[model samples]
Target chain A: MKKFINQADDFIPEMLAGIYLAHPDALRCVNDDPHCLARVGATPGKVAIVTGGGSGHLPLFLGYVGEGMLDGCAVGDVFQSPSPEQILAVTQAVDTGAGVLYLYGNYNGDIFNFDMAAEMAEMESDIRTRTVVAADDSAGAAPSGEGNASARRGVAGIFFVYKCAGAAAANGGCLDTVARVAQKAGDRVRTLGVALSPCIVPRIGKPGFQIGDDEMEIGMGIHGESGIRRGPTLPARQIADEMMSWLLADSPCQSGDEVAVLINGLGATPLEELYLMYRHVHHTLSQSGIRVFRVWVGEFATAMEMAGMSISLMPVDEELKALLAREANTPMFRQFSA
Target chain B: MKKFINQADDFIPEMLAGIYLAHPDALRCVNDDPHCLARVGATPGKVAIVTGGGSGHLPLFLGYVGEGMLDGCAVGDVFQSPSPEQILAVTQAVDTGAGVLYLYGNYNGDIFNFDMAAEMAEMESDIRTRTVVAADDSAGAAPSGEGNASARRGVAGIFFVYKCAGAAAANGGCLDTVARVAQKAGDRVRTLGVALSPCIVPRIGKPGFQIGDDEMEIGMGIHGESGIRRGPTLPARQIADEMMSWLLADSPCQSGDEVAVLINGLGATPLEELYLMYRHVHHTLSQSGIRVFRVWVGEFATAMEMAGMSISLMPVDEELKALLAREANTPMFRQFSA
Candidate 1:
């Protein structure tokens, strides 16, 4: 309930305005549709990568737009999908000779909105478009051997997808190639989150879910979806082992596999704790004979002020590793070399 | 406290170990002293910049040590100053004969410890050293013109000081010039914070400070120090106005002055909320006829999971602006251009 906001209804627009102010050189809003943010001076011939989702996840849908990253983003209110029209705005603004790519998480609302936008783009403007929905949250899907990985909900793993796909696009890859890389990221990556506390929406002024103070839920959704297992919070060593086991059980990373690691902090988790968890994650991966190509640990993605963390492991092929290492200059994320 | 830590006492060193693993390319630790971290191959002849403070205010003391920023940092336990020995270790590791600049906040413990380290370095190693303690927290200082600004505690404004001073050092500025610029940054910048809730240290397992559910404290310190006032929580707009007024009154930026602005989260504040607050901060700064040269909005310094934020305004001269605009590649901070 204690949030730094004015009128609750104005949260999304005000936040976008604030973002525009903070990262003026990196992003600009569409003329009539402020919800759409496009990179300043997007390359004329490069494929456009646009993403859209709820507003609460910082550095996700919009903050990803910049040089060597997404071409544009359509923003929505907190935990709410953007309108189809808003997604179309981004598509129209960033589209050049190359086709547009709609990249986003696999939530129901996002799926429907982005689908409509793709339809609208193809029908109205003759601008070819593709969709690469990320479903990397292993807990949201079925048992690894039985359930469809494409049906899982996306979490922090989507960032790696964005990195590779955006880099592919920036590298002047064909639309099909970009889509393929993105799809590959989706297939190779998996995430499992453990939550210690629920988050409050600025508008709602209350936590989205209720749980005991000493409890934690494994595989909790970003917006308070029920996690698979709930129990007393365990020590760092035990929790790190459990989460890593769940992730590897689903994706099954093995010896000598070149992989990228992300230890993502859910809003309130400290960087120090994230590193502590990463220490165990590093050990766990090393024990499995996984060779980490690159490691990122921070708040790459978040669920409002939720208190928890998510571990993401992306098995990296040579091509994927190259793309992941590509230059990225955004307000929140910046990588130097490809 | 429900924190992702194994044992409370193992927090600091374990966190540092995790950081070392996460960023092996950019940073390295002192072998004999794990408390000290230095940028790998810091420019040989460039003046070395070393910053340190208590732990917990992450991305502050250690995360800032990378290319084009601080050359090294001495880390301490949560809310406790680094020992003089630790500071001396970093100083000796990074000293390249251009002399060393010891930059840190003006907290009592940090001041005392860093002072001891500087003396030790001079007497033992014959390393020329200068100290530039940041006292930019307006809330912890005076009643505007009546009190000594140097008596204030350094809060988030210290980040701006670090950015400028470190950049100056990286740009081949002499030790005295770097120290002067740091001192100038410390003099011009001012910060005022508003806290809605208190934070609990994982080791303490209890709230450090207390307030009623609906109440708030203005100008609260990051370490739960007494603030200027306490009352019911106010809307973002009113709070922004009040904080801007206090900062401007203390430092008194002019109409045509170029300023660097930082909207720093105290912890547990979501990025959306931070941006929402920045909207008002931008408006207030714009209306004041002060043009923003650059703006940083995120958790630069935090007080565990405290639900609050601080606003820092640092007037920038031409030299300061150039230094602030210099490229910095750090773990948490990366700047592309001016």
Candidate 2:
């Protein structure tokens, strides 16, 4: 395993320290706990949005903490959920007179801890909190007709949830409104990913799964979870078309519908290839008579050094579109009006 | 080799088409040639800055062509210099009454072609052009005291050149002033890189170079060029200390200097590892009494999917710092004020 690391046990702390050092003006640790990070200053009387998830996905949970984005994040170890104490710490630090909202991916571990954190906040500090979990992975266990989003696992499409919900909170929306927006965005977005290679967790020092060099897994989860299909690596256009078909079929959109597209690199995939995928995705969308309002092509979320890409489509209304276009200044994402 | 590609020959054109498709509002093709890309609407009366180099380095040559940055870019094939005609096309399209400035990395093929393009622009269109070649790799052929920077290879530190020089042009500086600022930034920046593995060029379906599984090459160039040293991979801190020693030794920074740091991933390294490296870089600089003004940690320049990173340092003065802080909205980068 060729990695730039020191002691494996110190990985999370060291990375957190590095982030704080690099962007000291934009982010800070909460309650003297490095695992609980928040923006430098929390705005009073504004709904505070907090998220928490396992590590390995940069720009996902913690990287969104900044102005016009997430207010705080409770970081966890690799593929492991953060403790309830850490989540509560972030919630308390970010909450002002307004209530706190726990927005994160829908994982059993994360959900349990966040719920505990919410209960702890209510019992200990009398701070009200709400939850809006993102479960936008179209290829997850949930089927579209079942309407059981809680059975799905959130992936890169969670970015849309963060963008819409964070913007609502930044716009001084009430906590209930922010949670509603988060859930709406979460419901509207769908994601599908392909994995060419697996990433090694620091402590493990070996890849979690193995595949042939010329093979790939479609609909792979971020943490090397078994994908829906496995086959020989296909051409860029074919891969993009197949992924788009799955996403579009699962998403609720029609002819004349407008949406946003996110072509995300799952770590080692180059931006050049990401854009190539975007070309086909755009072409596919146009053929279906769908209008693309805005597009983002880069590594918004990653799975360590895994090699692959994920396509996310979010059908947007005027409300969601405005929030998506709002200026976001974060460690990992920045958006300005065109 | 595992790669997401169709025909190897279609790599550059397809990638260019994808870029134009994804960012139609911010960028446009020049003279019907996709290889020549320019900002959608160039700001007339402002000195135009045009840069070009081989493909594969996204955000390096074309990714910088947006607001507050380069006015145009002449894209070449993967690792192959673009034709002089392509460069001329970009120059002619972006240049207004104010002459153009040609800024790019110092390479034999690129310098020869860009110089020829300048002559063509002057003779055919009467659009005057000045040239500034970035040569900031501290580990290249040039020795620190040799007074021959031309022997050095331009690596990730060239980003400082684009950021500073692009800001000068955007601020309505004349061609001479912008060229001077570009040269000054090129002189102040120093870069060094390490490679744990090699990348495969698309046309050539094999790794460009090879190394043992446990070995790493320090001071390696972006294109798998031979480095200053090779040995077993060391811990993150030790690697940081060693690379910092080499960079600081070759640079002109003193104890009380203020500098901007860029920890660039050479493709496959994870953000977690990049921050671990940054933590050590920051600690080492602080211990030496060198204040870090700003830092950027991401894949600024990459070598396809090679697994490694590069460290770039530019000792900044008031002038350079102001330019670095200017707002830039590009396809790949966006910066806003605090």
* Model 1 agreement with the true structure over B1-338: per-residue lDDT tens digits: 77899888898878888988888888898855678888888677899999998889878878899877899999888898989998999999999999999988887888888999999999999999999888888875556322676568888888888888888888889999999999888888988888988887778989998999988888888888888888888888988888888888887588888899999988888888888888898888889899988888888999878889999998888888988888888887887765
lDDT of 2 by residue, A1-338 (tens): 89999999999999999999999999999889899998998788999998999999997879989888899999999999999999999988988969998899988999999999999999999999999989988877434223467667889989999999989999989999999999899888999999999999999999989988999999888999877788999999898888888888788876899999999999999898898888899999999999999999999889999999999999899999999999999988898855
Position B66, candidate 2: lDDT: 87
Query: Model 1 reaches what TM-score against the true structure?
Result: 0.98
Clashes of 2: 0
- lDDT for position B320 in model 1: 86
How far residue A56's Cα lies from its native spot in candidate 2, in Å, is 0.7
- Estimate, for each residue in A120-154, the C-alpha lDDT of model 1 and write its tens digit: 99998889999999999988664532267555887
Task: Specify the highest-DockQ model's number.
Answer: 2
TM-score of chain B of 2: 0.97
Q: Return the DockQ of model 2.
A: 0.83
TM-scores for all predictions: 0.98, 0.98
Give the per-residue Cα lDDT of candidate 1 at B122: 96
